[model samples]
Target: MKRFPGKTMGLLWASLLVCGGAAAAENFEQCKTRLFNQAVAQGVAKSVATEAFDSINYVERVIELDRSQPEFVTTFPSYYSKRVTDWRINKGRELLKQHQPLLTRLEDEYGIPKHYLLAFWGLETNFGSYKGKMPVLSSLATLACDKRRSRYFTGELMTALKLIEREKLSTDAMVGSWAGAMGHTQFMPSAYYRYATDGDNDGLANLWESIPDALTSAANFLNNLGWEPGFRWGREVVLPQNFDYRQSGYSNRQSVSQWRQAGLTRPGDKTLPDSEVSAYVVVPAGHQGPAFLAYPNFRTIMRWNNSEFYAIAVGKLADQIAGGKGLSASLPDLPAYSRDDIMQLQKTLNSKGFDVGKPDGILGPATRAGIRDYQIANDMVADGFPAKQIMQQLKVVQASETSPN
Candidate 1:
């Protein structure tokens, strides 16, 4: 899933005004009118566009959500814990058994394991207990007018319009997430248009109501994304006490043999299984945190949802669903950095010429890389994870009051 911006809703509302009087002055209905015309120009039938937009209202709540995804503030451990709870795990197991025949067929056809499919299904909508209730058309339309990511959401809105026409779905029935991701496996409009399938062979890819269709569509997506068969996403591993922290990250790919030679082992000090598969070490938290030896399939998971924490949670949850033990090491309770602190850290790094990109208060790859460079320069563990210590060291703050003991 895309990580949305995280700032005060007031700031987002103000951003519209800063674009000049025309945009700032436009009301919701005016933006809706323009979007409807755009839809018609883009090949949607005028009647279809009109009916879809006729009663659609701008969803202010959706805008608030789009500007505040949790990945920006929550640590990986916290995210993982909340997402991969026992309730979810048990529910996944029950659903795995309940949908075994259909899932098995999907697995055979698409080469994606049933557990992974179930994990995605569970995580996406909690096994369909709560597929979002917001009207998809209105949500997409509202975002299509929002300038933060207007182009992207505009395309999604068009795709959704096309999907309704092609699938013969009732316009009023098209309800989903605030971002317009729909069905049991929360697929975006483009993904739905491209990959949704009639797994039950009922002549309709009814993702919203059909478990078979939803699971099959999800499986088809992974299959198209180049999901490697017979490969686990990755493993939680034990690093040697003197292991080089600089070697951590998705960019540092190495063969299992090389990794073992460099003192990487499976949890409990077992040697990495002999294989030709190339993998990377990802230290999401830092040197003091649990490490993972992520494989190629991990990247495929990242394609499904770009966040490393999301991918890890899915992989681990799938493993547990398949009767494997969870992580061997406990996640450390790290210090929490507020949005202001992150923006200041990014500003400081940029000012020092580390190039963290514009300070949006999101700890993305560029910010992490900048932190790593700063850490390397200062003889600190270059794990790239932000901390109170790093902030103080860079003189971005005077003290480490938020440091976790």
Candidate 2:
């Protein structure tokens, strides 16, 4: 389910620009001026603050990207196929062997598996081949000045300034994603402060240029996030015919034994291993699609990236790198919805007294619950998937209301 933490920053900024006209730009400049003062108050050198902010322009592109993260809209199958490809897997394997010595050392020290590290490296920036080109300072400043998620981004901006001060990094050299996630494994500035490591012992983390530093920092981050050394991330499991669909998702967690007792098994009907480990069932594409019993380590992966699809991709990619089989089941051919459609759906559900909160175009938990309630009332499968059928049904109802009466 969708979970946007705040209002769309881009839309908020756009509305401000429209309402305030030229005043918006003036207000932004004023905001930047105040940010400079805040930086100085936070112990950033006045010269450093000036230098970082002087030539920085509000990167409109950054706002656009922040608003339209593909993971929010794309189906899991579409997203998964694009990321966990044959080339990536082959490259990951090659890198795994090439960096065996370094990975082995990291595993020994951090108690995290090597393949998972490779998976993160592969997925984050395509094995360091593309760490983005946007200036981190400008992107962070742009986002921090925006109303949405300003508190978080402002703190990140301060941390970035502190990073420059402590690490003695050139602001000009600090290039990364539109949201200011930097380096090979795309660590946010705060994360860089907390977990970045000098793997090569050259007195710098150097996630930009040093593979060892990037990979080591990744391992350290996961380890600090509580990565279990020996346990696998999770495994694809086959549910029993007519199994309860309500038992799926991260909320309905149970021990491995309990799930096995409830008729969950490996894809080939193999018995689950005798373990006391707790896991939750996740059916990303609903009951008709493939299911997985996500282990505790899966939660650890979620700490790295909160998205279920992303966590699954990393785990499955790592599995492939470790010589495991690919997914046996295919994704169902379900019709996709645009953001506007989702917003309309939420609005319609709210009109029907479903209480979907604000129609923010995000299918969050509340929206899903509303959809499920609607489905249950209409005697449909309450999967909360928001498929094309629901959208069409809503459209027909709207048409009826708007027609001559």
Candidate 3:
């Protein structure tokens, strides 16, 4: 969950990379040879480097995944519903009670809450049910050889080799997602080297085989990521009917008192806490969807996975595992826009000189900004949400059309 940049959903398809077409590189043998030599140069013992290389193979599907782009961006409702399930919550609660003594100790030592740890544990591999089966060295080497992210992944591959060399771990024993994230927490090699903990005090930080190691390592990871000790990740809040949509984003930071004064209230119209902790408004699904007063801890959660949807899921799951209720607001049914429709919208926005960058059909920040600008210019709601009316007005779709896609 921590350093496989972009979406963590890559874990889902990472297994598909196990077998496929031949290497797309000019010479895969040469690629492996170079990687082996580079590993040796990076201080991995030659024997260990050779052993690692012997286990390495070209995972051709990783190349395709690396170069591919998402067509349709997933909505918050879709994402939240999938991860924050009743079963997951119940399981997490069961685990929390089962490990209460250990979790309480971790919270005391690391200043991280027990429920948040369980949230991370549940989200990143579902309490160790599956931590991927892709060969770590092969996948890292395959990605390192690719020109797109060669430099960064080369460093990661080097780190992985170093980990193998240091720990004397068998290459066959080292497996993870196609992106090379390992163990229950989906940590990259560097994270393992830096933050892996021996919570059970058995002397080794074995994330794959030890629950204590995995959970404690996760706590250390979050602690180092600047988790606010006592604060909740964030909470769903109600925006006033006349709340300005333009002020709704991470860029707009204000205190709880300030937001309370600006008409941000709790779900049941309860006033916000008078405490002066800083928070920002994140309308992840835009104005019509649930809004949250994302605290500093929310930013820390982003450091874990770097996705608003992921962070929201973690926070909400933690809340439920601690016996809290669900979100008060119902998610509005969004227009089922295809990749082509969004791509066309992006093109339209760019043509009008809104600078949404190249159209990739993903509703990234720039596209949201472009939509906001267009909406504002047209005297529309300017929520930056790419709502049905906005897309239709932009001619990305016809007003008479209803999508079943």
Candidate 4:
């Protein structure tokens, strides 16, 4: 009877797989036909649309990209070190010099500083050396069909079609990131629609071939995102002993006086006289690392990529392009552990009656909050950063609580 049941289950699984494959193929065909008809209705030649759609297949790479995945995630230090190193800095400086007039014009127009623009150039594509190796249409189509983020990817895919229709780009030339972000600055198709500008005035904002378009478009994006003219993003600062960890996160509004009252002080450089603008405090590595008082402009930078590390890396890289020194502080000292170790640590904490959120390997905010709760219960400093010492202590606590004496 058991063998009979196993065979039935195997047949059911095989049938389901076949059905799913057929549905996906059907969906792709429907999407392609709809797109071709729409293009024709909008005056695009039927032959052109047909030719473009003929070879486009649903690419599998887009849905598989999660940097936090086990094979992709890496240490923050290593990540930033490679991206904001001497080579990038030097290249940015050369580009800055080479394109001073255009940079000046962009700065004047958008009020976004030139360094920030060039920094994006360096970071987004390493000065346009490799602007991704994916087909934009296929990638978008695949991700749009993916169950995870279908809505968002489908919207972007439609936006890409609009770009092709407007003659802003040709189908054959729309290669980009597997996630459908294209050109030198990795602008998603929708972003290109909204913020892209023709700084070179060749009638189109061609970020693919024109240097002016990429830099100016980036500046325009920042400007539209609320960058204040003649104002700095944020200055590096030192937190006094016993800084409040709870109050630290990205901020768009905190008066300079308020921060100063809370013991945030910029070392060496005198605080520029701008006391009215709101700012938020950021301490990337808990309490032990260097801190900064991020202004509203900093939040604007964060809008480009909602990661503290990404924003700070861009800010720091911009500073490097502007002939500023490297970071004046270091990261909090913590023993680096792999994903498996962190998962085990989380499980141990959970078994010892401390709810450390899910025992997933990712060390996100909830996990940090749980660890902090555990630390406070055990009379340890609530730094939140995981380390060898904390993991060992957790083990000891778990064993003591679980031992059947």
Per-residue lDDT, model 4, residue 145, is 65
For candidate 1, write residues 316-375 as lDDT tens digits.
999999888888888888877777878888888887788999998898889999998988
User: After best superposition, candidate 3 residue 276: deviation in angstroms?
Assistant: 1.6
Ranking of models by lDDT: 2, 3, 1, 4
The regions of model 1 sitting more than 4 angstroms off are 1-27, 41-43, 68-72, 350-355, 395-405
Is 2 or 3 the stronger prediction by lDDT? 2
Residue 293, model 4, lDDT: 77
The stretch of ten residues in a row with the least summed lDDT in candidate 1 is 396-405
* Model 3, runs deviating above 4 Å: 1-26, 396-405
Give the TM-score of each candidate: 0.87, 0.88, 0.90, 0.84
Best by TM-score: 3
Q: lDDT of each model, Cα atoms only?
A: 0.86, 0.87, 0.86, 0.78
Candidate 4, 1-405: lDDT as tens digits: 445588898998999978977788788788767766765776666666676677578654455572237643355666677788999999999999999999999888889888999888888999999898888888887777676776788678767777776645777788888888889999998889999888887888888888988888899898888888877778778876777565665423468888877777776645534487778777666666677777777778878987777777888899889999887777544556778877877888777676777787877777776777777777766766665678888778767877996
In the order shown, the candidates' Cα RMSDs to the true structure are 6.9, 6.7, 8.2, 4.2
Candidate 3 lDDT over residue span 1-405, tens digit each: 446645555764564443323335446788888888887877889988887788888887787777776666688888888899998899999999999999999999999999999999889898889899999988998888888889988999999888876665778879889899999999999899999888888777788888898889999999999998889988999999988888877888889999999988999989999878989888878778898899999999999898989999999999999999989999877766778888888987787778899998888888988888888888887789888777767783432233465
Off by over 4 Å in 4: 1-27, 34-48, 66-68, 71-73, 251-253, 268-274, 332-334, 340-360, 398-405
Per-residue lDDT, model 3, residue 155, is 90
Best candidate (score: lDDT): 2
Q: What is the lDDT of residue 50 in candidate 2?
A: 87
